[model samples]
Target: MNQPLLEMQDVKISFTTSTGVVEAVRGVDLSIYPGQSVAIVGESGSGKSTTAMAILGLLPGTGRVTGGRILFEGQDITHFNDKQFEALRGNKIGLVPQDPMSNLNPVWRIGTQIDESLRANHVVKGSEHHHRVVELLEEAGLPDAERRAKQYPHEFSGGMRQRALIAMGLAARPKLLIADEPTSALDVTVQKTILDHLDTLTAELGNAVLFITHDLGLAAERAEHLIVMHRGRIVESGPSREVLRDPQHPYTRRLVTAAPSLASSRIRAAREAGLESAELVAATADGEKPQETVISVKNLCKEFDIRGQRGEKKVLKAVDDVSFDLHRGTTLALVGESGSGKSTVANMVLNLLEPTSGTIAYEGQDTSNLSRKQLFDLRRKMQVVFQNPYGSLDPMYSIFKCIEEPLALHRVGSRKEREQRVAELLDMVSMPRSAMRRYPNELSGGQRQRIAIARALALKPDVLVLDEAVSALDVLVQNQIIQLLAQLQRDLELSYLFITHDLAVVRQTADDIVVMKKGQVVEQGTSDEVFENPQQDYTKNLINSVPGLHIEIGTGENLGLAE
Candidate 1:
């Protein structure tokens, strides 16, 4: 491979804990050649992001490189000091962190951060720096880069901020680009767009990329090579197409099988095999069933006030007369584009925001006029996992404290009992008890999210509201979480109010589907019925817009579904 551009030889990372030393990444070896795009895939806590962080010299303060050699351009950069690493960082190896929401300085202008990232390693101050910043932004495919350069990170949308992060990463034309779950939070269209840009950039720059993600589909689509991590070691590594088509390792095969698209296919195949029909008939035999109605809404309305340029006010119906029912032990997915009131309905259900009009009932109880105490108790029965895990968690608290807070607030158990419960909850979420002491910054995006889910399940809530819980996760971790949710729902008979824009997730996770448009339910049915025979124009449009819809596994080329 012409002396790989970057190499990690027998890399090992550990963190000192009260109990003992915890090994995160163990005896792992990987390499990246010029113009090559390699993906690192694993479940949460598998050290995928840890490996990427090590590459960028951005590992947490508590972590130590127990043993390894990080060779960048054939030079062992493992022992590089802060000053040396800082110099090499942007100029040689740029990083696009997973969560741009917090990685970006909310107070600083986007242009300023991009310039700062570039100037950190190489000085180019004043107007020259500004020009270069704008140029980099343009190269990253951001529209009106010149004007956007003056705006703060908050002024930009999630996708725009992610593009800005990429622009910053490319500011120095680094030899290698490391993107950790770069498109994890984006919708399918935006995710495809981002990957397309990355592909274009790699081809144009001839720079190697270390793309860290869990989505096997995305990794297969974007990367030339794939590396699968399990626990702390590499289980599989090979050409993306080969590995994806015929994964050798059990872990890799499990990941591929767990992917939402692949899972959906399995579901379809099982239905064709009459498995679903038999299961549905058996489930139907459970008499009366209260129709399994977990959540019922009628004429739900939400409005937002937007001000005019002249300070005049305008009340807009963000969600208008939205209505749907969530059945017991099944996922009811709400799908729509950005600003489609999917989240608005979720917020209303959680009682985080008051609705403008209409009714929301849980288990035949009207929640519209509940008192503060009643609402608080209702919240205990229904918990939420937000879209951004980092934002949802308290930065100052450890994972243990974060999970414990909910239990304590609900007065579910005593101090010692709560501690034990917290441990069990962590274990239930497939996280180690040792994660308790680590802060949010100490964990990866997927780890933090698992903790968030654990916290939500602390009180054994009957209903769980997952608002893009798996959206920010890599494909592998996303699969694990999806499986976990399915298992948990089956075991506990828990109802999931899954709010998402991803049609793929809807297809896999949802039993019933609710298609929302302008805050109204345009179409509703079983997932199979909705996707296979979408009745409404809006629902059909959403299904048509799904990316990678026509990707062929055996053909090795575009399946040619649509552009």
Candidate 2:
């Protein structure tokens, strides 16, 4: 075999804080050969990202490699200064970070950012930078590259922005391309497109890829080798399929069991089996949804008037004649890519935004012209939990205060009763009561999400608008939250209008799915029906985008034990 493009041997990383020295990565060893694809999979704080940062010399805040060596082309570059690392960064080692909006310059045009990368790395002469930028964007699967190149970051959709980042990363055709959770925020179809294009580019350029993600299924699909990191140490490393199919470590097994792509069908099957055994069932014998409709929508339309720079008028149909019924004690997931009007639909349903032409009926009551008091009453029955756990919670307030505030606002009960209700809510979400005094900053991402759920449930709402609630979590944490939601739904008989781009998660949780594209419903059906046989090309693309389902890891084998 040829010499490894990048190598890490007994690498140790640490950070200095006011409290003490904290070891982030310890005694890690790995190698990335030329054109070889590899991934490090782990939950938050598992140090998978830290390893990538070390290799790229982009570690933040008092972090340093305390031991071992990192070799690039058989030369030790572990202790290279910023100037030395800078030369290698966009030239020999490219990076595609997790978030595009943050990585991109909001002030500059998309083409400008790409041009800067080209100029910095000397990929092309300055005179040829603009043409090269357009070529790169088009190569990254973005359409209408010439027009798209002139647009700013906010003007582009999430998928387009991601393509721009990929273009920037591969602009120099680096020897090693590091993708840190690159498609975590994207929809399944767009994610698949991005990964496919990335694979092609890296393969064509003979560039090795180091993928960082919390999803084991994604790792298995995108890479040949899988490295599982937990608490700064590599617990398992092998062929991706072998590791997923026959996980030796407890953590690896947990990841496989929880990954949505691998376990979506299995989760549904298991949940249904449990329901069949139980005295109470959510569905009928024929697998039909409950006849009782909780929220009904008809001909919902939202239009935004866009005025051009010269004051020319254009109409943007955000939600075009969309209609769906949310049944009692069932989940109806609105699935689509960004700007598909799913979130806009959710907003109107929540009564936060009014539609230009539509009717929303809560329990057969039209909500269009509800009185102030009636709107307040409606809110008590319908609460929303947003996607960002970190941003949703109030850092200044304690967990108890955050949860109790909703109860206090609604005047649900007396002060003592509200306190008791908050306690029960915490217990329902499987959170320790000790967490009540802690602020959002002190808790992990999963814990914060649980708190957010608890807060939303404080009013004993009949419907929960979970807008990408668990999308930001790790697979294991996401599964835990999903299980919690299931238990809550069974106990409370709550109906959910779940909004997300994650079809795999929807496959397990949603009884019915409303697939949208360009502000229109592309397909609508039962989750099983939709997943088993997608009727539309867009729906099929979404299902195909989901990784690891094609890999045969059955319930009787690896996953039954996972459960």
Model 2's alpha-carbon lDDT is 0.88
Candidate 2 Cα outliers beyond 4 Å, as residue runs: 265-289, 308-310, 559-563
Pairs in clash, predicted candidate 2:
none
How much RMSD separates candidate 2 from the native structure? 2.9
lDDT for each residue of candidate 2 in 391-436, tens digit (9 for 90 to 100): 9998999999999998888777898988888889889999998888
Model 1 clashing residue pairs (backbone): 214-474, 214-475, 214-476, 215-475
How far in Å is the alpha carbon of 485 misplaced in model 1? 3.7
Model 1 per-residue lDDT tens digits across residues 1-563: 69999999999999888998999999999989999999998877889998888877778968878898989888998877788888788898888877778889998999889888867767466659988988888877788989999999988878788889998888888889999888876766566667788888889989889988777777777788889999999999999878866677767776766666555544455555566433222121223333578789889998899986479998888999888888887788888876779998999998888989888998899898999899988988999988878789999998889999988888877899999999999889889999988899988877888899999999889999999888876676676677788777777788899989888777777778888877678899877789778998778767755543434342111222112
| Predictions: Cα RMSD each | 6.1, 2.9
Q: Which candidate is the best by lDDT?
A: 2
